[model samples]
Target: MNQSELRELLSTEGLRLLDSLPAWHSSDEIVRTIAELRKAGHSPGLVAAVLSQSKLRAKAASKFGPFAERMLFTEAGLEQATRLSVAAQHAGRFSKAGVKWVADLGCGIGADALAIAALDLNVTAVERDETTAAIAAFNLAPWHNAQVVHGDAESADLAGIDGIYLDPARRDARVRLTNPADWTPSLDFAFGLAERYPTGIKLGPGIDRDLIPDNAEAQWVSVGREVVELGLWFGTVARPGIRRAALVIGDHGTAELTAAADSEDEAAGELGQYLYEPDGSVIRARLIGDLARQLNARMLDTSIAYFSADAAVATPFATCFEIVADFALDKRSLKKELASRKIGTLEIKKRGVDIDPATFRTSLSLKGENSATLILTRVGGKRRALLAQRTTFAETSAATA
Candidate 1:
């Protein structure tokens, strides 16, 4: 939001109204709410701003949890903000390293700062966007140990800070900036901070691996099976002999796999009784070999991340599927085979293949009461389809990254 609208939303009347409104829902009648709000003697701008914030608060709940109730946010700021649970891990590193004070540069909406302050550590959060900085200040007002500064992160004063965390702005005016150099406080500047203090840089999981510094500990973190961020830690916070790591958080709890480097893959073998799909974080961390070894599994294809085993294994790092049937990659024959089995409810999974699952589903024109999963991939360097059922160890789909 712009400065004027921000002022309106922060006003006593606006905040009270926002708090009084019912939680936003997709099915909620927007026109009626706007009319009712306008008729209540609130200005049009104030009503619009508060309504927008109410919706944003609902969306922010996924990341901020209960804290979202009292927090303020900008659309872009909330989008880039770290999930509180994940941010707590980032905060723990500094705490474990005995860093009492942290400089959270480019701290969008003060997410990481909130996590840090919750640990009883002092934090200085800096942001360049005027509106976002104000929103961050509102969110952080509850933490006496936290301070918000409206200034450039590259020039933010880090004098007494024991640790530094930088999340460079990767977007501009709602458009993503793909070039690393385009990032505000550029990688050159953020990475250079490691020379002066313990530093942590949060990057997208898809960032080029070659761009990562050899000295940093690259940790790929996944929440609920979704690979979220790649955090590179340097100096005291960086763990020795841990160059690559996968941190997975799920309903079952958290699981971690770390290695000094990418582990060598086990030799590809013939199709086994079960298939295991590694979580995105594991695949991104390049520790699939390590995970496979832990599960006593081998790769289905040397080039694919899919693993095959003689028996089902229960592990949080991967999802298990019991193979029921295998078929050649022929559309007509596959359709006939599925129809013969009365298969209707379908979960399509694919790797090392070109077909889109949705299109294939439509092409099949399926109609049956029974449910089954279809896995389209390569076996022995040739296309094949496997009909399988999710085993007890699997919680849900570990979506392909």
Candidate 2:
């Protein structure tokens, strides 16, 4: 949004209109709301701005929860903002290190800053865009210890800051920039801050491992099975003896695996009763071996992420499936066999395979009463298809008991 639109959105009248509007659900509702507002004599800009904000707030709920209702957001700022749950963890790192004040560079709608302030710590949130900075100020207004500044993050004054949190803008013109140098404030500048102060740098999960500093603790975080971002903690913020970690956050809570170095890979072995698929964060952190060892499992193939074990070992690091049958990779024979068993609903999972699940599912033209999961991957250098039944924790427990 532009400067004027943002100003209008934060105005008394604009906020009143936004508050009066219900949650935005679809395009039809938005059109109807626009017509009703226009008929009530609201300006086109104000109506548009308020409606846009309503939609943005609705979308932000997933990231910010209840706080989204009271905050203002720009499209780009909202897109780049960290999830509140994850940001709380970041704040905890600073708080635990006895950091009383922090500078949140590239704060983006003040998400991380908000988390810091919620812990009763002081935060100076910096943003380059004036509109975003204004939105951040509005979002952080309730916190007495937080403030927002519109300026270049690299030049932001850090005179009395106890720690730093840097979330470099990784997108340009709505497109994600893959190279570290392309990020705003640049990786060089962000990393340079860590040399002087305790710092946490938020980066994309697929960041090149070579670029990571040797002294820093690199962490991969996943929220609800999706690997969200990689965080590099340096100086005092880096936990002692922990150089690499995979943090998984789910509905149940959070779990983490830490190591001084990459875990050794487990030996590839024959498929057994169950198959385990490691979470993305575990795979990204190269901690799959740690999880495999916990389950008493081994890799299904030397080069694949899938694991196999003789017993149903429950673990949060991976999803376990019970092996029902294994067969050659021929589609015709597989289809004939499935048809004979009256298997219909299928969950096709694959790794180290070139096939697209959707296209393959359509090709099968499946129709039956039974539901089953399929694992299509390489086994001992040969293509194989394993039909499996997904096993939940409760089912496993009941069966073993």
Candidate 3:
């Protein structure tokens, strides 16, 4: 959103109109709402801006929850903003460390700063974009201890601040930048702050492992099975004896696997009765072996992340599936077998395979009463398919414990 549009949205009348609008449903509804507002004598800019923000607020609900309803967001700022649940975890790190003041460098829309301020810590939220900085100021205005500044994070004075949280701009003109140096407030500069202050740097989960500092505690966080962000905790922010961690947050609550160093690879073995798919965070954090050892499992292949165990294991770090049938990697034969067994609903999961599950399922022409999951991956250097039944951790734990 531009400065003028943002100014209008923050106005008393504009905010009232925006709040009065119903939750966004479809494109037709938005068009109708826009027309109604325009016919009501609202200025074209105000109507357009309020309608756009209404749509964005609906979209932002998944990230910000109730706060999205009251906040202003730009397209780019909303895209880059951290999820509120995840931001709370970041804030917890500082609060637990007794940090009284923090500098949130490159803060977009002040999502992280909101969490930090909610923890009762003083926050200086800095954004380089003038428009985004203004929106951030509005979002953070409710917090008496928080202030938004329009300036370069690289030049922000960190004096007297107990900690620094840096989320560098990892995108350029809507495209995600893969190289660390390509990011605004580059990784080098963000990391340099570690030497002078307690710092936490947020990065993408797919960041190069070699680029991570040896002394820093690197963590990969996944929410609901998707790896979202990588957090690097430096100096006092780093947890003792934990250099690498995989933090998974889901319906089951938070589970963490930490190690002093990267976990070693487990030896590949024959397919067992149960197959396990490690959480994306564990794979990204390179802690699959640690999870494997916990579950008494072995890797399905030397290069793949899938694991096999002889018994039903209850672990939050992985999804366990009981093997019902194993077959050679042949589509026609597999289709015939599944058809013969009257298997209809299918969940096709793959790793180390080129087949697209949707296309492959269409080719199967499935029609049956039974439902099963199919895992397509290599086992002992050969492609194989395993028809399996998913077992929940709660169920398995109750039976096995």
Candidate 4:
């Protein structure tokens, strides 16, 4: 949004209209609403700005929760905003470290600052973009302790700051910048701050391992099925002796696995009744061996992450599937096996394989009413397909012991 649209959206009338509008749904409804607003004598700019905000608010709900209703958003700001649940953890870290004040650098739309302030801590939310700063200021207005700084994050005055949180903008013109040097505020600047104070840096899950500072605690977090962010903590906030951690937040509840460094991989062993696919965070943190040991499971292959165990152990770090049948890794065999079972619903998963699940699904021509998960992988240097059924929470609990 430009300055003109921003000005209109920030106006008293504009905000009132935005809150008064019906919850946004389809684009077809936009046409009629636009016409109605135009007939009501609202300027084209105001109508466009409010409608856009309404639409953005709908999309922002996934990340911001109910706060999206009262908050203003820029498309890019909303895209980069941290989920409120994750932000709460960031705040809890600073609080647990006994840090009284936090400087949330690169505070897009003030998501982190909101959480920090909600914890009753003094927070300085700094944003380089003027429009985003204004939106953040508005979103954080509910908190008396939160303040927004419209300036360069690197230049933000940190006079009384007890700790700092940095989330550098890793995108330019909506394009992802893989190189840390290209990121605004730069990873170097973030690492430099870590040396002086309790610092927390948020980066993409797939960041190069070499870029991670050896002394900092690198924690990879997954919410539901996807790995979301890698948080690097330093100084007092960094837990002692813990250099790597995998935090899993999912349907089973929150579970964490931590280690000093990457644990040695367990020896590849025979397939058991249960197969465990480690969560992405566990895989990225390279804590598979540690998790496997906890579950009494072993790697099914040296290079593959899949694990096999005798018991149906329930753990948040991985999804457990009961292996039903195995077949030679070939389409003809799979077709015949699938046909015999009358399998219609196929949840195809793969590791160390070249097949594309979607395109391969078409090849199988599944049409049965039943559902099953087909794991295409390697076992003992041989390609094979394993048909498995997902263990429900109840089944997993029953098998746990």
Candidate 5:
């Protein structure tokens, strides 16, 4: 974006520019470019945001520098684009259901819209902000039948839309949340939209379960093995039950749901001969019971997320690990054993331990050959540690990137 066009974009539209300067190809080049852009009228924040997004896009090899120059890559837009993995996740749902038409509401930069369109879905994308709407339009230009409309979804006429999708904007250019209440159209309002058609609501993983309407089936999704987003599905496939599903794309794995009967059942402790830790997505979905049933695993502790089952079973739901050694906590002994192993990397995964792993590793001088996962926790109310490696079955058969 040239200085003249950029100044007109910001000054005439009452738009808040976030970042818009090219990344400093070199330190001196960046200083020179910023000086020139400022002289031509560009805010530092705007310059920074634009350059940051450009850098990120460059990293991803998205050759859209000319487009970035015009758009404001605010923290919110970057976060909505990068942090929220719901678009790809919702696309996965379509891949599972074989659906082809999707209505992407509040499409922002059209990241999700593009993803779904890539999967061959006819996308009807709507955005409210002229600047953001324009960016979304540009991002989705490659997809045929991608209709980018400028309007608020809360009042937009909804007709002939097959599958509904909404991503409520929560933050502004300053990176401050505009209104907590505006995080989304009310659930009541969303339900109204879903009542007319199948819908998916993209939400933060931290959203409370109580906020989820009973009419919708909520599923937490992880992409590339990380639990990154949560979604609530409303319509024909929506279940009136709490469920958790793990999607390991390119593999055939059963989607598991928590039975009503099981939901009412209290969790119990079952520290047995083996231990299983459900993938983050499974845990987020609250499908522990289904996972246990799938693997014949039982809970190791009522309050902990660990699961245990004796029989050998291979499921994408979790990584099964055989406990080879369990010992009491003794810093001296641990340091001695770990040092003797010549361990160089100490990967500490702890539960119920008050010690900081970094300090602990440093204190123990854990920098040699003992590069393994060290699990520290309280079992039977006693502080202890477990040394383990990926089980052969898990190492070979587990779903991992």
Candidate 6:
């Protein structure tokens, strides 16, 4: 018996064969099982199915054929599989503006493809693996306009697509990016696509700022306070300012926001009565510079991410905090005060210093029933941490920067 024979066994008697094999996690076990099936005289399809269905590769096996085996299990796949909201965001960017013909290049698992199709856009999804292509087809079966094509996208004919969304293989199917560039879409292909149409390329947060083409508009995106993916928009959609987007999902619904760059004068002078902290994406995109002006807030520290102003001007970018208490670093005094109150739950936040929150929590030996939000960082070139509680003043924020 050979590979052909083993495959036959699986097609004709898959359940029977599965029960007889020992459980294992390694690909080696699958190889060994194939060998055993061959010795027992199985068919090629049976062998293929069995190997593909092995626990180690069950998902890939379920979704793809042999060619897709290279996809392997990966973090990116898991993220794509689990984070439907993120994919929907990518899709919404194009679909919301009435772009109907969308191309989802490198559409792994058809996550973004499904999202675009759900928005009533006709999508052409291209994948390099037969298995992944097949799986994508199955995933898009409900959408009449969603088609999955098997091939390399770089050379694929994409003449009619009105808008293109590219989610490059930022990581191997196993999801670890040994070299970040290894998973990125080819720069030439990406730029070409952007030059041709309204295109968005998904990128890792660690992408170099300098690498972004001057003609393209770059955005930093964060979802739920976690900076997830960066996006580059080109062609007709490109703009000059950096875009920061934040997404907030709540019980009622979802809220998304995008803030562009600002050139307002920096706020100076004394610490105001209120402090505002912008969303991470806003801070990263330097949208806070504009947001501060809108909120009438000034920078607390030139380099610090926090903002301060005398009056509160309502804005979505920053969360306003009524200044509760500000003090210098008096470890002994603070510890004694907390110890007397039996403050056990200590929250430490710091900027500029390499202090570990855990060590500080331990050192304080704070044991108290009262809980407080702590800010640990340098203020005006001094090292200190502030303690406060969350206020009703919510900074409706998103994850896109």
lDDT of 5 by residue, 1-401 (tens): 33443344455322343333334343446667667767868667666545555555543333232444443443345556633234566776655665667888888777778778878878888888776776677667778968788888787666766778887765554463544365545556777788877788877676766777666777776554566667778775454554444444313433344444223212555455566777777777666666776666666555666766666576666766666567788899988878877777877777777989888888888667546777787676677777766565545354332
User: Per-residue lDDT tens digits of candidate 6, residues 24-64?
Assistant: 35545556667778888876676665555445344444233
TM per model? Answer: 0.96, 0.97, 0.96, 0.97, 0.74, 0.72
Quick one: how many clashes does candidate 4 have?
1
Which 10-residue window in model 3 sums to the lowest lDDT? 25-34
Q: What is model 2's C-alpha RMSD? A: 1.3
User: In candidate 1, what are the lDDT values of residues 1-401, reduced to their tens digit?
Assistant: 89999999999998999999898998999999999988989999999999999999999999988889888888888888999989999999999999999999999899999999999999999999888889889988989999999999988887888899999888888888889899987988988998789999999999999999999999999999999999999999999899999999989888899999988887798998889999999999999998888878889898999999887767889988989999999999989998998988899999999999999999997888899999999988999999999887433333211
Candidate 2, residue 60: how far the Cα is off, in Å: 1.2
Q: Which stretches of candidate 6 lie over 4 Å from their true place?
A: 1-76, 96-98, 129-131, 173-181, 238-265, 311-315, 393-401
Q: Candidate 4's error at 112, in angstroms?
A: 0.6
Candidate 2 has an lDDT of 0.91
> What is the TM-score of candidate 2?
0.97
C-alpha positional error of residue 326 in candidate 2 after TM-score superposition, expressed in Å = 0.9
| TM-score of candidate 1 versus the correct structure, residues matched by position | 0.96
Model 6: lowest-lDDT 10 consecutive positions: 392-401
Clashes of each: 0, 0, 0, 1, 15, 52
Query: Which 10-residue window of candidate 1 scores lowest in summed lDDT?
Result: 392-401
What shift in Å separates residue 400 of candidate 6 from its native position after superposition?
Answer: 27
Select the stronger candidate by TM-score from 3 and 6: 3
Residue 88 lDDT in candidate 6: 72
In the order shown, what is each candidate's alpha-carbon RMSD? 3.1, 1.3, 1.6, 1.4, 6.2, 7.9
Model 3 agreement with the true structure over 1-401: per-residue lDDT tens digits? 77799889989999999999888766556667768888999999999998899889999998999999899899889988899989999999999988899999999999999999999999999999999999999899999999998999999987788899999998888888888888989999998988888899999889889999999999999988989999999988899999999998888889899999989989999898889999999998888998998888899997899999888877778999999989998999999999998998999999999999999999998998999999999999889999999997676876476
Error of 5 at 108 (Å): 1.3
**RMSD in angstroms, candidate 6?**
7.9
